[model samples]
Target: MELQQMRYVIAVAETNSFTRAAERCLVVQSALSHQIARLERELGARLFERTSRRVRLTPAGAAFLPAARQCLDAAERAAAEVAAAVGEVRGRLAVGLIPTVAAVDIPGALRDFRRRYPQVRVGLRVGASDDLVEQVKEGALDVAFLGLPTTARLTGVAARELARDRLVAVVAPDHPLAGGPSVSLGRLATEDFVDLPAGTAGRIQTDQAFAAAGLTREVAFEVTTADFMDRLVGQGLGIAMFPSASVHRLTGVAAVEVTDAPARVEYVIWSPVGRTPAAAAFLDLLDLPGPGGSAAHAARAALGTR
Candidate 1:
């Protein structure tokens, strides 16, 4: 009828004597008998056969024992799993990221997070800023990195500023423009450009930099993925604009600093605002050195970077 009743039935059956079962269960012999009798009546079946000197199971008792054991086992496993998660000891943590963050520091952070919480599963998803925001808001993702989108009119969600992903112009190394000196914002439009996708904040910043230089940008191509933009620049498809940290492998493209360029702010955002221990651990690790900065700022300086 209930776990307590099942336990009473099992105790009496195992000890095979009312007195011993009562002693083992820490109950009076009469109380133990009443508990077992209650269970038998609830199940509409007798679970034991009593003789003057001893007790033995009815066929029903033999059949029900394993099921009782199974219930106890399942209850124990459930409690353990819940405890592990609340203690930050284990469970799946779903993290979402905009393309740039995924390319920038997530790989190393993921490696370290796994080393610390090997029992916790880390699930990752990459998307544009809008999608990342939506994922966290709908509870589809636990947390994610979003390129700082500062539109005041934007809806709900909490954002934690992570780092600034400085935007820079990228050109094929062999291009005539690549041999030139460090350019200013004014010089940005001299060459035709590979554009960021229209309507995105990155694209707006790219366009404004050219505007500030008193020149108009000519779009040779428009792209969404910074990863692809870098690869394409290397192949000389076109000069691409992207976050400086997201552009790697300088073999074919030179990632040059653009003076007076607007830097994109990156943030780690969560849907519910309050963070899980695992997610908080990840955010804390990001502040460390190594991939977070140049050699001047070692691993210890990572989190200290504003």
Candidate 2:
């Protein structure tokens, strides 16, 4: 099947409406439909099941979607590689980060990257550190910012350490423990806590700290974003442990140093191989220190450019 047919199928699957897909593809409904039908006939499989109320991907379509996407991505990368050989970068840059990332100013960096390479399309996704790392490893994300426990190890990816910080106890201004000189993990464990979801890299650090301290704490609320954790702490619903760098930004919450608090390292992770030119450009903008030189050199090495 032609690449155009695959594009049309992807659009229809994503929008679930032929008319909307046509609009997205910038083509008429009939033309998009005709291409998909032609593709279906060639494959001898009905890609979509159409009904008056809705359109859904058939089993064949479900199976075909991922391969179609991979084909398009491979084709785009081929084009980008050709462009890069001539000292021009063109492609998509997909970046993922946890909400509590503090080492890099994402918006400022993106702004600069766009100014430097206007041909590259940029996309950002906010997710857990583990998920972001996995996405980078899978090549779904070109780069990711991760905050993991100081003891955590990264595998199957190339990474550069950005910053490190100890977590602080976050409590409402009126909280009984708010004015403390410093709190211990044991003391903090005595109170209810608001935390990132269990098992997440963000939460694992705190969980491990408490466990190592021979204490058990109750998590009164589990939320994804630090803002929600801060809000809950501001309401005196529960206390939270946040990276010290992030505490200053939280309103109505007082940060008390935790003597035995967990320390986290912020890292930027990318694929160990197959570095996209766009990804390389963005990493260069980060300008992280490396053994050889700037991260850009590493990116170039990954692209087989000595």
Best by TM-score: 2
Q: What does candidate 2's lDDT look like per residue over 36-148, in tens digits?
A: 99999999999999999999999999999989988998899888877776777788999998888899999899998888788889999999999998888777898899899
Query: What lDDT, from 0 to 1, does candidate 2 have?
Result: 0.87
| Steric clash pairs (candidate 2) | none
The lDDT of model 1 is 0.67
Model 2: C-alpha RMSD to truth? 3.1
For model 1, the stretches where C-alpha displacement exceeds 4 angstroms are 1-88, 102-104, 149-155, 211-214, 285-306
Best prediction by lDDT: 2
- TM-scores for every predicted model: 0.59, 0.92
Residue 153 lDDT in model 2? 99
In model 1, the clashing pairs are 186-213, 287-302, 287-303, 288-302, 288-303, 289-299, 289-302
